[model samples]
Target: MVPLLVILLTLTGAWAGRPVLLPPPHAADLVLPPDQWFTQKLDHNNPGDDRTWQQRYQVNDTFYQPGGPVFLMIGGEGPATAIWVVAGQWIEYAQQYGALCFQLEHRFYGESRPTADMSVENLQYLSSEQALADLASFSAAMTEQYALPEGTKWVAFGGSYPGTLAAWYRLKYPDMVHAAVSTSAPLLAKTDFLEYKQVVKDSIYAKSGEQCYMNVQQAFADAEQLLEHPIGWRSLTSAFQLCAAFDGTSSLDGNNLMQILADRIESVVQYNEDNRAFSGHKDANITIGSVCELMNDESMGVPIERLAALNDLIMTVHEETCVEHRYQSLIDKMTDLDFASENNDATRTWIWQTCTEFGWYQTAEGAEQPFGQHIPLSYYIQQCIDAYGPEYVWIYGGYDQSFVDAAVAATNAKYGGRDLATSRVVLVNGSIDPWHAMGVIVSSDPALPAVYINGTAHCANMYPARAEDSPELVAARQQIGDLIGQWLQED
Candidate 1:
């Protein structure tokens, strides 16, 4: 699955110039009370400096019992609003235990900015460690200010990257966090994340069967060949209806365009159901099953024709109401290849984290990955160089291979990844979630149990209970609630 923050940015229309199709909200519009801002310190380490900024947060006592636990929902690289408090399984759990729901927006995201200027220099303060410090400070102030009963328990909850934060917070502050629910949390930090695409391929194959998978794979091969020849390049561009001009140049642009389309197809499977929150399209009910149907054509056609059908399906699924089919429009829209430009604050912040802390460059190394080797580790490393300047990228938090290697090793050693040793935490993952490759599937110690839900995608069990949900998902969510209940009753 794509990074939680990137998905959220697209949902919030933060792509600036991209004509992305917005998915529906998680549920009915939730009317939250006035938002409150915390005067957070500019730098947590430099407490003596005394410069502060407003950090946005929201609270709901809709189901509060006088002496109940406080549910602190940590936001990812996105805005934290009322939908979190009113429309998720956490809210349902909150109602069950009469817990007070509160969400803390991540620093540098939403209205929680430490500095007005979004220069790379200012974003230095935006790290997971600093974010945890913010949570600790804010939670203390919140408890004291609200006077939420003397011995109220605190539980941490998050999904995806924020899920990693939730689990890490518990590991870091076990005394403060009574329990944590981390769903689809990819704890491992790796430079070459080829496993992500392998999982995507497996998910499609599993859902669509071997024949459909081969057809899709062949379609990618056909497109690759088509980009090599001048005549084929023209035909390929016309077939896909791309807005970008094809000057019959090298296959770099064509490969980039194909990768973008592949990402869209994989994303459809990654967030098939609970996708509304991630995407703003309410009618986006398409899944791998749907795409497979589109790929499997009955009439005999050449490889190029098959490729065209797949591209058409991608556009149909992504933008059913668009006047034209576009993929990272070179002239009018954001190109996937242009991510190196740090013009957008969201992209800049995310890439900085990846370069410095988590080097999760989703690359397709070998033939196993159907997406091709266009978006390799070098592609992302170059992005860091371009965005943060060559000097800074090489010195402080540079994207050098050695620096990234050390960072990933250090992060893995510190966090424990699949071998995470933590207590009072419910680790949940979906079988179809590509990020699940980096998530914990089992634990030798029962204290840190992992739940693997079948036929589910990224954070599938985290959404509000729905009638259409699989029985396994329903049961998995119940198990999480039971675990939290048990933890709350603990000494």
Candidate 2:
């Protein structure tokens, strides 16, 4: 899955002069509440470890009334922004129910640091189990601190990985959490997430026509063919605007380049037409339609040339100077343990979680996928080994697929995977969201309702209502609101 913060920042760009039918609340208009800190146990599992850390959080009580339900927006792999407490579909629900709202930053992300630096030993404390425990403790503390009315319902709202936590919170602490809205949450823990790419391919084909899919497939094929020769490699370097010349001999370079290209495409497909308010920016017209237009534009030259132009477009939007395809450069960045280094804390922390807990590695190995099969499953496993050390491999037994398989199996065993049986939880997935493949798109029980929005992308329902939103997304949000309301009315 794409990092939640990255998705927010990348997809939600400046309006770029696009007309807005009804503009959503901007950052300047939002009166963000002051940040609050709560002293939390460093290791809830270990009683012997008396270490404590001040976890960052924010609260918005504007619409709160006596005995109203509490809405907790759980933070995921990224920093928790105070804007979430003030602006979001959850905030609208808060207003309707007079609910008190809160957003807690996950430990080791943003300012909620549990250690001095991101050393491998320190990262051991950053597991999903630990995060769930954090939520439990935080909820109890909030109850006592606020002196909430007895049996006042508590609802959890989250998207992406935090959505997974929101659902699991209700499952793990049924008494503490009354209900949860899990949007685009991947319930399963798999090592080789081949389905991720397959969904990407499917989403492109579904959104764009068959011609667009064929064009993308041909682009990758052309890229791979060019990588076969030295002259072609030089041409690719010039065409793609690589920071360094493409190394044809190094499989690492080729793999990195291909993955970068696939990632750019995935980003567009994942958050296509998602509201820009989530990122606190005006919306840019960066949807699947725009991408397909670029891909199928004969005026932009052949498929490979159009592919290069697409990369350049993303680069311009992100303000990136040049694309870096060096494998060691990524290793160097991830290995940086300095807490002060930009993005070091989050990058390393999330990678550690994947290596130990959820192995949601998106690899392009299947033949049906549009992206080339250059990115092997071993490439990701090696990344885990490289980011951490031999200890990671040793802990799991060996340095092979079996090790990753065992890790993934343990996670799914602990949690019920897609078969997670829970009550008062709404599983929301967009038809175009690649992460939906691993999510609970269909529920076997009525208590565990599933809302599958057609022609939507990742976490589409979580954002504030937009005039441009499809009818399906609007209806999905209404269903989710009604479900939460029903849960609150329960004993």
Candidate 3:
């Protein structure tokens, strides 16, 4: 799954300047369902307050039989696309089991507006607690609306953050959902996610050769050395074709540039060999192998020079003129409170959740990682403070690292972190996906199976089957299907 925070950062010029790609068209034979809305509570915790908002949802009952199970496809930090109801591996499962399928857009994302604008006061209503409540309410409402049987079995399916929610939902409300399939879900809430980059480094070494890995490490080292000198800064600016000159003395600017460079490779590695149709890019074939081929090309000069050329190649693919390295530009874009703003709305919402509930900040503080230690945990904390305010940061206690640590701990405590003891919830992770480090890759309980695809990227099994799919991925899907079938039969 393409993380919503990364998408937002890319849009606001904080990360790599990659063009946002929409999901490719669904199967021609499948008919796309129309958007439907249900009234959801603004604050699920308050009983007296009757405030409500319109939550968007879609249903595809093309293969649903009268007494078959119901499949709920939970939306994540991004907008819920209609294509999900028509296509995806879950849709195939629905067809096989004659199950009714539904996709509900998360609050404050897509068209599910809970308030007029994204003011700090309004955003208080948006939380995972409230979202889970929304799901419960949605389930009861759907039952009444569709006249589903009292004991109808419901299976939850989600990927990425939604995947986390899917597992948590079953844990919190077992009666509502009988089974859950969580793909690439980070069960642990961490403040400094250094292991994320570590996994990326390992995946690079595993997919590409040692030379590619060494060159990437060397490139980051060289870039860090250049940032120390003013002349070197100018040279890098010219080579990378930056929109504005970077301040050599400012660590923030240096970190921004370094983070941007890291994001370029991270994105490629995170979605390595994922279906082009799922990624919605014509050149979705960009993989670790392709990136290694570029890095190993000696004609591009030194490692740093090759890195610059790679940046240029990414810009060319996205049709961007120059890389934006100014940190304040990113701040300005994220600080915009207008919900009507094109792309930053979803970013703002997700970032707020990260600050409040989950601190999944991917920092480069790990010693062994290829990326330099420029992007410290403080950079992300500062972003939260700048985007929201000191009040939001101080709400957890203080604006220091301890506050984030405490907040993440609270999140994990509320829901079982990595030691999630839930039944009939299959945890799925791709071995190459960086998020897997935080997920439950091994299960202690036989009922709670964990499927780790050997050579796959994020959400690889969530997408429809392909001829190029790895044998491991194919086997994982079959196992998941068999598990779901067994659960339904038991029900």
Model 2, residue 209: displacement in angstroms?
0.6
What RMSD does model 3 have? 5.1
> CA shift at 297, candidate 2, in angstroms?
0.9
Write model 1 residue lDDT over 106-213, tens digit each, in one string: 887666678865555676888888888888788778878876555555567767788888888878866666668778888888888778888878888878888777
Each model's lDDT comes to 0.67, 0.77, 0.78
- What lDDT, from 0 to 1, does candidate 2 have? 0.77
Q: Check candidate 3 and list the clashing pairs.
A: none
Q: Report the error of model 3 at residue 33, Å.
A: 1.6
> Which scores better on lDDT, 1 or 2?
2
Scored against the true structure, residue 195 in model 1 reaches a CA lDDT of 83
Q: Number of clashes in every candidate structure?
A: 8, 0, 0
Any idea what lDDT model 3 has? 0.78
Off by over 4 Å in 3: 1-30, 343-345, 390-398
